[model samples]
Target: MKTCLPFFLTISLLIPAPASSAFYQWTDAKGVVHMTDDAHKVPKQYKGKATRIEVKEPARLPEAAPPEPGPAADLAAPAAGRGEASVPGGHDETWWRAQFGELRSELKTLQAARSQKEQKLVELRRRRAIFQRSRDRAAINEAEAQASADDARIGDLLNRIAALDLAASKAGVPAEWRQ
Candidate 1:
């Protein structure tokens, strides 16, 4: 009973932080509809017209652990990959389209790089014995180090893509736009 008390308390504390309860939308003088998580941000004049929309965000399941690499590209990596910087203009249609285009292009580039790295890593590992006998152990070590860096970079690219997807989902962008 004592252990369960702390566990329940922790869960209760964490639940409200990520799950936004409501969204407030109001129009500015320019007729730009602005949506925000905080009601306080709504202008005094527009408060009466502001719509308080209660949103029930979908439960996010914990990410599954990445599996070991296999002989083929059929593993769970995205058909495309991704890269740096957070996309902006959450509610703007033009921005959303631009963000989607940029993200998809970057993803494609990263995916190509990922494929190249996978091949390079394989070849490096395969030539381990040859490198060992050539008295160029440093070269082999350098290749191994590069492989590690490539893994980290590829992982980051994948994460950036996932974040974009999450942002799009939250903004209620069309599913087809993500493709």
Candidate 2:
């Protein structure tokens, strides 16, 4: 505990010091600028002689390029296939469309499942509130039990969504479905 006290004090000091103090800078005869804690330290001859130094900020630089994909990308690299390709059938670009269609179908199913779970949770909560208002022992007990079950179901759905999120990430799909 004693060892932690000093660490805590040091961290407390590191909390942003309010901008209360003013800074003063001046150049000497040799044209070398110097800064001091006290203005009086500046020699009388050089004092009030140098121009008031206005702070000129450095120019903003352009943003850096994102780092190139490394080992991970190499390991999970997609096949060297073109964006859209002609299937053996020589019909419309059916193969490429099929992949997107499959993803959309899965997404739709997940959304419906999530919506149903949410609606059930809402109904459970409403019934629980109604039971609580009734002030009957049996009603309260039943409502509380049902609420617990609903909570467990909600947790299960949340875990399922999490697993789906990992799958979507691996499949290079966006997070919209999970949300």
Candidate 3:
């Protein structure tokens, strides 16, 4: 028994261990590709199309330098341009705050314009319905045309409002300022 122990140990050390997991790939009914470790998890219909996939481990990236200690460390570092200012656009905090205020104002103005246009559209639609009930073709046509124009205007205002809101958010405006 003692003589056989060393030989068994040597054989075990010489053999390579089997991989613990394998990847399988398949396409679903919606034509989306998927990968998983268990073949049984795949749908019955897709099993026939499933293919074994060999996954290679990704290479590790080099370690990054330690971050600088400051209140602005959590935020993204300023990009290169203009001066050595710390803010994103090479502007000071006061400048950014003023920009945020302007964006909020613009957003409010656009929203008000959109609201007015929407109200006009609703009124025009009501007038069109009344003309239809009275069988007045000319009146109905006029109201419909006005409504269509108002709809286009309202869509434009909404888009502008969305753009302003996005700008304000990117400027890091406070939520209370948005209101």
- Highest TM-score model number: 1
Question: In order, what is each prediction's RMSD in angstroms?
Answer: 23.2, 25.1, 22.8
RMSD of 2: 25.1
Q: Candidate 3 has which clashing residue pairs, if any?
A: none
lDDT of 2 at 104: 49
CA RMSD (A), model 3: 22.8
- Which structure among the candidates has the greatest lDDT? 1
Expressed as tens digits, the lDDT of each residue in 15-42 for candidate 1 is 8564435667666889787988898988
Model 3, 71-102: lDDT tens digits are 33324343334456443333344444444455
- What is the model-wide C-alpha lDDT for candidate 1? 0.55
TM-score of 3: 0.31
Cα displacement (Å) at residue 65, model 2: 35
Better-scoring candidate (lDDT), 1 or 3: 1
**Candidate 2 residue 27 C-alpha distance from true site, Å:** 59
Off by over 4 Å in 2: 1-135, 176-179
Which structure is stronger by lDDT: 1 or 2?
1
List the candidate 1 regions with Cα displacement exceeding 4 Å: 1-90, 134-136
Q: TM-score, each model? A: 0.41, 0.27, 0.31
Q: Tens digit of lDDT per residue, candidate 2, span 100-136? A: 3444455455444544554555566677677655545
Extract clashing residue pairs from model 1.
81-107
